[model samples]
Target: MKLIDHTPQSLADYTTAQVANLVPDGRHQALREAIGRHQDEALARTIACIDKVAAWRPGEFNYLHSSQYCQYLYYLANTIWVREKDAASATRLFLLNKALNGIDLFYEIAMPAHFFIGHSVGIVLAKATYGDYLVLYQNSTVGRHIDKIPTVGEGVIIYPNSAVIGASVVGDGCVVSQGARIVDRQVPPRSMAFTAPGGELALRPAPEDLLREYFRL
Candidate 1:
């Protein structure tokens, strides 16, 4: 993939610099080395992830793009956490991503391979069961209730101000509408979820075309 204004090594250096400035935990060397060691793999994984987003340019990564940068930072942090088992280094990257992107994604959460972050602001993601072709918009949440996490299926779009929590099972090709909540319910595949009168979950059939708005799948 083509990187805009940065090679892999330069991006690693730049990311480490950001962590040093923002986190300032005096572990710059460790984080720098960790990022340097894992940057190439992390960026290759990021390219695989971003290539699925229909809204983005194919085969090009622009660090100046806020949402793309957010995704890359998450992959870098996740790679360090999973491969190096270095929580300190990973945590710094997570914090730096939150600071710069206004998103609250932690390092421990295991996201799917190909998901899209439409906007990065105020999106708090829990360690829920995410699937490929997932779309998370600004102010959207995927959280747990009383330790019961959500299961979001493939080809799903969680629009702005929407949430699926508390053991909710969202099926494939579902669209959680704006300002809707699906709490402990099972939404059928290829359905759209919204709030019925008096705060009940309502469903209607949805087209796969809706999900294609955000993903190429």
Candidate 2:
């Protein structure tokens, strides 16, 4: 079924009906409940983020209706709602993500606005902080070590089956290669971190120079 056929020019052009149709059929009520939890400012921010993502991917109409990105939108909205002290709504969205995406993401985790979850399944983000435009793939883990946690920067992409743990700092525009393990280290901006044969991480310039052209840097 076609959920969203046209892209709105702005958030003001988006109607509740359109949003309702975009969400999964059985999840409409939950989406409404979660949106209802947002106050004026948080609601505005959430709407803006939705609009921004839609505008960012204008050609991909399915992106709006995809369960993966939809769950991300809900999580982003819940983060704003929780910051505004709307605990009930936050908890509901968190549970909804777990139920729909099958991932464990705590509501207290700091997921900033404009962050992107490429694929939601098997992803864990228990980091200290996440910057804007972050992209997380499936089967990736961003955990912590003891009391210290990883701090990710803007436009960072963590590929599938990769893990970034411990007091690590990932700079802006850094790409963690698939299956790489980064712990207790720092990655420079616009660099790529990949695992060597001996399981040691090697840092080099990002393979694709056009990454900034595709992602927000």
Best by TM-score: 1
Off by over 4 Å in 1: none
lDDT of 2: 0.65
Q: TM-scores across all candidates?
A: 0.96, 0.71
Report the C-alpha lDDT of model 2 over 154-191, residue by residue, as the tens digit: 87888999988999999988999999998989999989
Clashing pairs in 1: none
Indicate which candidate wins on lDDT: 1
lDDT tens string, model 1, 18-124?
88888776889898889888988888888998787888888899999999899999999999999979999988889899999989998888888898888889899
Cα error of candidate 2 at position 183, Å: 1.0
